[model samples]
Target chain A: MILKSLIFINGFALFIGFLILFLDKVISRYGTVTITLNSEKEFKAEGGKSLLRVLFENKYFIPSACGGKGTCGYCKLVVSEGGGEALPTESLVLTPKEIRQGYRMSCQLKVRSDMAIYIPPEYLEIKEYTGEIVSTELVTSDIREIKIKLVEPESISFKPGQYVQIRFDVDGDFDYRAYSVASHPDTQGEIEINVKLIPEGLGSTYLHALRPGDTVYFSGPYGDFFLNTDSKRKIVCCAGGVGLAPLKAIARYWLTHASNREIEFYFGSRTTKDLYDHSMFEEMAGKSPNFKYFPALSDEDPEWDGERGFIHTIIDRHLEGGYKAEAYLCGPPIMIDAVTDVLLSKGVPQERILYDKF
Target chain B: MNLALILFASIITSNIALTYFLGMCPFVSISKNIRVASGMGIAVTIVMTVTASANWLILNKVLIPMGLQYLQFLVFIITIATLVQIIEIFLDRFSPALYHAFGIFLPLITVNCAILGVSLFAMLRVYTFWQTVAFAFGSGIGWFLAIIAIGGLRKKLMFADPPENFGAAGITAILAGIMALAFIGFTGIASL
Candidate 1:
């Protein structure tokens, strides 16, 4: 009787499983559809996958934070044709104005039919790269510097201050977190990034645990906070904590590529131990007449000798007569706001003051 | 057993939501907006009807005949989950409009205690096949009514400006409690 009951239960379960499978096969089979991008590129994609996944497979990387969950609202793209009405989930993330303008979260949009989408010009250049960690060093107590050597398609071309998104698999769903490149853009075969542990931050925890031989997948060359090489005005760069990564790239690229341009870099930390790699900037300053390095500490310390107090308070002392400078600020929101105010008051035009706040 | 009375009692007096309080998770969450709440309600009603009826058949015919009545809980839940999946696929294929309206909510219904509760209750009450269907449908409608009412109340309560300590969830719980009390008024009018 027990054997008979076991067989009966198994038979019932198998029958239901097969039934569900049959229904899924018949119902979800939407066939193949053509995905046209930017009115220029077109590819055939399976109808079941989301537009974001389809695009990702095609090597076109769109910046998204919450993977394809539609929670981040960062994967917005212009779907010009064959895109249906926005679903309820998409409506929560998208503004009414954006919806009216035909912007939809590609992650939430299932590719059920032939469709046309417009990708931004710069995003077209974004590429996914797989690399092995060449080195990992604890730059400070909280911050670690990771250097990665690209394996496939070994060279990457990106502006100095742009960032990349590292992909992580949480359960089965994909989650991406962005970090700015600290290495010089000219270092095409490799990249470096600094990660500061933010207790309980998923990306930081994962990245911090990575060893030298581990492999990672990341996409990009995103963000517009890069060095404006065309600008003839003097460059004023300021960074706080780990925000120095992108600014380091920008300053080093500027110092190496265009040494004729006057540039000053100001790095702020809480204490002496919080500050890192001032010697590298000092070395660069010694070589280049136009480059000046100022490392400041906000908190009191007996061992400190350089500028004290906030970086915003010391900005005026450096630019007594020189106000024709474009400011590049990257830090916490409060620091960025305070520094931007100082730069604006110092006669830097609002448009010329670029910032990326963490 | 009078099927009409079962239906009436379930919908008005012994509502699965207000009285039994089975599917409180979706009740509080989906009740924030009437449109989504109605969609969820309709989806829950459809799922409950089919799963409850299927479970009743399985319990009376297969389980009792095989003397495997002890496996009722497991078998009933499996039936509900599989039936929900099949219903979702069928709705997607045949009823495109209805599928678009509540299709996304089908996944949410798979683990809903309310659906499981209907099947278990039918088993406990020794309900016949048709009676189980009526009870499930009525319970679904009862849940639907409660959520919609709470949603409308919450919408108006947004402007009332309750204390800061009573956040959205806190305010919603209070609203559900009050609504449950109001539903109690119909207790003696009709009962199973």
Candidate 2:
């Protein structure tokens, strides 16, 4: 009886397994579907995957902040044909105007049939690069700067203020986090990024633990927050803490490319110890006739005697009324809002002010 | 055995959720609003009926003939899990709207004790094929009714202020107890 039961159970389990395999094969089969990108690129893909996965498999990576969970609203693409109506989850993240313009979250939309999608030109210009970490330095109590030397691609050319998305594994699932490049735009073969350690943050903790000689995979040069070299107006830069990264890049670019243009930088931190790269900017100010630097401390520092107060007050004091100034502000949201108000009231046009808020 | 009487008794008098309280996990957690509760109710009803009928066939046709009735628990659970998986794949391929509607709840149905309870009860009662199908379908409908009634009541209960310790789960348990008491009035309506 025991032998009979063993055989029966094992045979039944095998039969059920085969039945499941058969059902899965027959049901999920949808043949091949065509994916047309930007009316120019076309590829045939199997019909059971999401548009985001299909694009990723085909070497076109759409930035998905929530890793295709449809929460971050970053993996949006214009599906002009055959991608179906936006799902309830997608509609939650997409604006009504964006919906009207045929925008859909690629992660939430499946590719069951032929589809036509429009990708931004800049996204196509983005490339995947592998690199080795050359060094990592703690620039402040909470911030760490990592420098990576390009290995696969010999070098990279990107705008000074743009950012890169680094892909890493955390808890067995891949997470991608964007960090603005902090090195000079003209720097060859290597890129530097500053990361602030946020409590229990997946990306920040992963970044802060990196040591020299570690390999990293990241992709590239995203965001429209770069310097507008075409604008001849006086450049006004405002930074708070680690937000100084992209502004430092813009400052380096200004010193090299546009030394004749008038530029003023206002950096704010809670204490003197919170400040970094102060001497470099001061030296640049001393050397360039048209450049100025102002570093402010919000808290008391008995040993230091530089400018005291928030950066917004320093900007308000030095901002002249009759000047055409193009402002570049990067910092916390509150600091950006305060400085934008100061700049607007000081006669800078609203369109002339661009900011990247953390 | 009279099928109509068995169906009536299982639905009203011997209701699975109210009388036996076999599936309280989803009962308390998903009984928040009418729409979501009803969706879960429909999914549970369909899965319960199908799995119970399948379990009945396996118990009577194979286990009884082979005298391997001791393996009923393991076999019943495997059948229910595999059937739910097949159903999900079927829905995803042919009816994507239904697939999206069921969404996460389809996989969740595999673990629902109410589904396993129907199969076990049918086996314990020595139910024939048609009788087991009737009992399972009626039990699903009964559970559907119970959850919808509580969902409506909880929507109204949100407006009234309650004691601090009587939080959401506590209040749901008290309400379920009261509902079970109310169902006791239907005890003599029918019997298997």
What DockQ does each listed candidate score? 0.46, 0.47
Comparing only chain A of model 1 with the true chain A, what is the TM-score?
A: 0.81
DockQ of 2: 0.47
**Collision count for each candidate, in order:** 0, 0
Best by TM-score: 1
Global lDDT of each candidate:
0.88, 0.88
User: How do the predictions measure up, each by TM-score?
Assistant: 0.75, 0.74
Provide the clash count, candidate 1: 0
Across residues B1-192, which tens digit of lDDT does each residue of candidate 1 receive? 899999999998999999888999999888888999999998999888888988888889889988899888888878988988888777765655577788568888989999999999998898889999999999999999988998999999978999989988889898888888888888879877
- Compute the lDDT of residue B70 as modeled in candidate 2: 94
For candidate 1, what is the recovered fraction of reference interface contacts? Answer: 0.58
